[model samples]
Target: MMNKHTQVIRIIMIATLQLFALRNTFSQATAQRPNIIYMMSDDHAYQAISAYGYGLNQTPNIDKLAEQGVLFKRAYVTNSICGPSRAVMLTGKFSHVNGFTDNHSTFDGNQQTVAKLLHNSGYTTAVIGKWHLVSDPQGFDYWNVHPGQGDYYNPDFIENGIRKRVEGYSTNLVTDFAIKWLDQRDKSKPFFLIYQQKAPHRNWMPEPKYYHLFDSVQFPVPANFFDDYSTRTSAAREQEMEIARHMTDTYDLKLAFDLPKESQRGLNSLWTSIYNRLTPEEKQKWEEAYKPSNDAFYKAHLSGKELAIWKYQRYMKDYMRCVQSVDDNVGRLMDYLKANGLDKNTIIIYTSDQGFFLGEHGWFDKRWMYEESFRTPLIVKWPGVTNKKVVTESMVQNVDFAETILEMAGLPIPTDMQGKSFVPLLKGKQKGNVHDALYYHFYENQEHKVAKHIGIRTDRYKLICFYEKNEWELYDLQKDKSEMHNVYNDPAYGKVQAEMKQKLLELKKQYKDPVPEIIP
Candidate 1:
């Protein structure tokens, strides 16, 4: 006859042993999978990062991937806008298939995501920081996202379905939560994390610590800062994004903020709202940093091209300051991984959602299929796999992100996804270009006056069709890299233009995209 308590103790001991056995088995299985950390920043142009040799500013932390692993020179996005670019990468599909063609579209949350596919493959997934997608993240084990476009200073973050305000700069707070999640993740399972940055976006705001980072340097003005756009289309000449005419005094230049509410215009309210979001200490520090410069700008009374140049300098300095914090935090993250012994078994990637114009063509926002906006910065580090300090000109696009991650992790890519895996490119198996041509489409027409269009880019030529206006433009990269002169009517390019048009139509049909009836 056994006592009841003794019997219960025996059963409990058996279960505990079984649990430990299961844990050991899981750890052994997951140890073979490489951990992945994907870091993406908003509106960060390739020209701003010194690793690209654009000579604007230095980003040592971001440059580390290029130094240690591989740098992609011809990387681009399916759509060159914020929300659509992210959506395309997430679903591994084009904007039309995903139903998120622009900022106005909502992400279909019920659809399968790359995160969901990875989770099914036994990886613990987490996404922290800016998620411009309107829906709450699905299939991620943990997520803390900023609402809407996200404020740059003292912002609010929504964590695990609960909204809370964090008391620090957006970059610092986002990084803190990301590291904290890594510290708390299940060690027995491989992890995938997306560390999204909100810095270097429009109306740039820097951390108090980096306010004086670029004070000593006077950035050079771009050669085409005074682009006449005389030979361009109606959309190019009518845009409201020029630094000279569109960038307001208070909103962009930070000159004045004391105007009466009734007198201020729509853009003027932006300055007041951002200033109001800060705490007392933050507000004081911001005023201290900009007050002297603002006073000097007003007293100088600069006008015309000189005033435009002055505003460009102010904008660049502020934008670069924000970029500095992003690089600093990237260093912190890499350090953490190195210290934790995760560096050797992890794959690191650094990229932006899309490209941005830094005083290029005298424009600010990204929408057109122009080179500045079409080409994004891409750097990847696979610790023991990739060649060190290699630069590849493979024509990779953002839609390939999902399938690439899956292939790297040895997981099966879903058939619904439109992107093809570029793992062979990373493994150094493919010598020449894997893609013969790339297709592009833009849907939004009202914002910034960028007209809707479709185009194609090959090795030596580019062709664009503004179907709505029944117009076309062609560029020969070997001759006109600036894309200033439209060569559509030039008899010299007649054959090349026709070939690109046929290929563009073929790509549209292959990708299941609807062609416009008005196309020429």
Candidate 2:
């Protein structure tokens, strides 16, 4: 009954209204979601990264993230070990709460995890690479993790109840798997990806291809490479992980040595067998690296102490060479993200299972609450959300990582989580402090002989009490950054130590830590 032009006008108006409604819905959905990517490295340290002022190594990609976002200077782990730290990061709970107090304690997959929370909130969650926790990983839509520490070459990955041994270096393979998963993920929703790398860890064995890469340079030993462990607590006196004396030759570590004629023949045979397993190119590179060190050892007629120093230098050089490969791979990941246009949207994070001693305090591995072992490297990049080139001196615990991720994702934090959200600190809105003090507990009485110790670290002081020994150690971090002096016995700092001890008590009660002994 109506004219054709009138009917056409009515149809156009209806279409316009529908389009407006659709636009409003889409904007609301997009505003609620933000993509997150968390990348962690094994045994990576703040002191080793060039952005944190390590002169010997260059990590341009890691530094690039720092250039674009916030670099946290005082990031500390709850327990400075592999399994416990990872558990804390995933659950936002302390080791005792999560029941992962040591490497021996198995993680209960039934417990709530960040991945589970994010996935339940409609985010695609994936974890690719080194999962040291004892239980099977839960809450991930797709999971591919290394079996135990994993191998530098030909690592095995457990994928969906199937363990498949894959060839290629662990770092490259992990990255490849992560990228493949990313490509296949549903693009309509936001994602949470954990790309963990097993590199520069203990025994310090690099891929054969990277052996000759740093051969031209001699990496200097740490300034405190020969610490005497004097003027400190008794715990410092018991560690047996020295880089020079403890490294085994069976692990392909570079060592300068001389022995009896018969022993020399045996050594030659061992080296020959190890070399035979390598490709021709690898053999060539190994020979080039060993030749000069061998010549120097024979030419010097070294004895006793001088011989030990030579071995230390060789070990240090090889360790740094392994780290060189890790740095290169970091650059590779950053490059991939930038090339794919995901770098701007993704929140890049870099850290480690725990910090390791690079010849500091004459220690090699980590299990202690010492600064070198407890402090980890933490860098975050969130494009256009935070300012560039800013350093936050606020205290951050590894347990807070889970809550921070949830906060950034706009999800309600679980009530069981003991950590506070650090999202406000990252956004540059929280001015006062993220945490007034951080609590630490390590129950793994491992080879390091480090006793079960619980402590609290404030901005100015550290108070630690060894439970079994019933002893305490205090240090003023503002004055003694290296923790070279223990002031627990000093009468002058009695009041200060008492205050810190009280604070430690308060934290223990708040967190419901089981081993609570009020410091007198």
Candidate 3:
């Protein structure tokens, strides 16, 4: 017979063993799974964010993510246009490889996507807003997207198969829908949610409530806000996206009217209708207290040079207003995550469809190989996974996002993806550098009149060759971050330029770029 002390010890040992076995099984089941929340803003610029040090605008929520995680100093898009960049991001390939080189180019829904891969690997995936790829969004279990650009108010959302017009601010409505989906989704499984916002895109119009948020302050002008595009190449000289020239009074951005003309009456009516829809106290304050000096200029009958300056001021003001609203919505989302206890487990990313030229090259829209339009802001926050307050100067491309997502979840990268994972860098592995160099190709021959160009950006310099113009422009980024001066033809930098050209040629061959005969 066993002694009483021995029997008690044996009972305790059995209970402990059973508990260990249950814990091991639970950990195994939960391992290799994480929740992903990818958020993208439309036409947002790297310079606009306070974290990037432009300091013209404030983005506290986005900056908070950077404070808590890693901030990528040099993040680029495959193509500098909305549609193609988005497609490249989804497919983890270049614009040429994905067959979406322009706004008009349609995306084949059958293509392999990060969403599909995540779904197949036992994750529930959903895309909430702005699917501009011109295809029925594939790989997502649920999708609610803007028709195109979308409306500031009373926007139409194509959810599943039905096109329903939702009456609310685009940003708020999109977020509400996203939160609803989060609330209703299967709690037992991991989820991948893409919350894309259409706010701050072209013709930056904000909701009535957000319109006057930044009215009291005068936004500072960019140092190169009045760039002449003189020292740059011929391609820069030929572009038509100038803030002083191309901004119109009618289309997307319209200012207040002093004395409504017959033509202005229609716009006035719309503004009044929008204003009247607001609460009585809100409308009273907007009409009586809020008076924009821009209205007086718009009401003036000026011609030639005076009119051009007036338009630039109006454009800048309205554009910043749109951005202000976007910043607010970003704050709202961050607050939701923190309040719900999802902040710690979730990884949040913020970026744009592509970089926008905020009058940097005297340009408004993107689709150029220039640095302002090519580079975008990328911020990632993963609690306990990424070190706090880290800034990685390594070159990272938008295409790499897909592979990085897979790697974060411990999933195998697809063979078709051209991008490599940067998860190791986030985890403090620091393999010297993330990329030796980055490649950029923009094939969209669009409204800007910029020709097809393929370029390479090394740590120190950028080399771009305009295929149609038969021209080359080089910039030494180490010395010239503004890219105000071109040194392609300078004899002093001849050796550096020549080496970059050869590297470009080698990359073209490696990436199978279809452009024939890289002109030296």
lDDT of 3 at 485: 89
Question: What's the TM-score of every candidate structure?
Answer: 0.94, 0.88, 0.87
The TM-score leader among the candidates is: 1
Model 1 regions more than 4 Å off: 1-27, 518-520
Clashing pairs in 1: none
lDDT of 2 by residue, 1-520 (tens): 8799999999999999999999888756754577788888888767778888868677777788899878888899998988888999999999989988888888999988999999987888899998999678899989999988877666789997689988677778888888888889887778899888887776566766666655566666666777777877667776557766665554535443233446445435454443444556655665676778677777898865566566666655666666777777777777777787776677777788778777676567787777988889988888777648888888888988999999888889988899989888888888656889989998967665677899989888898888777878898888988888889979999899879988888889899997756445
lDDT of predicted model 3:
0.79
In terms of lDDT, the poorest run of 10 residues in model 2 is 252-261
**Model 3 over residues 1-520: C-alpha lDDT tens digits?**
9899999999999999999999887656654367899989888888878899976777787888899888888888878988888888888988778888889889987988999998887788899988888788999889999887676667789999789988777888888889888888877678899999886787676566655655555555457867777887788778767776766554534544233455445445555444444456545554453355545655787786566555655666667777777778788877887798777788888899878877675568888767888889899988887758888888899989999999988889988788889999888887556778888887766676777888999989999888788888899998998888889989999999999999998888777778647676
* Over 4 Å off, model 3: 1-32, 255-295, 299-309
- Show model 2 residue runs off by greater than 4 Å: 1-32, 252-288, 291-305, 516-519
Candidate 2 C-alpha error for residue 500, in Å: 1.3
Per-residue C-alpha lDDT of model 1 across residues 1-520, encoded as one tens digit per residue: 7699999999999999999999888778778889999899999999988899988899999898788877888888888998999898889999999999989988998998888888887999999999999989997999999998888877999999999877788998889998999999987789999999998888888888888988999888778889998776776787778888888777777777567888566878877887788878777888889999999988999999998888888889989999999999999999999999999988998899888888888878788888999989999999888758989888888889999999889888889888887788888887656567888999888768888888888878888888788788888887877778888878987888788888888988888888575454
**How are the candidates ranked when ordered by TM-score, highest leading?**
1, 2, 3
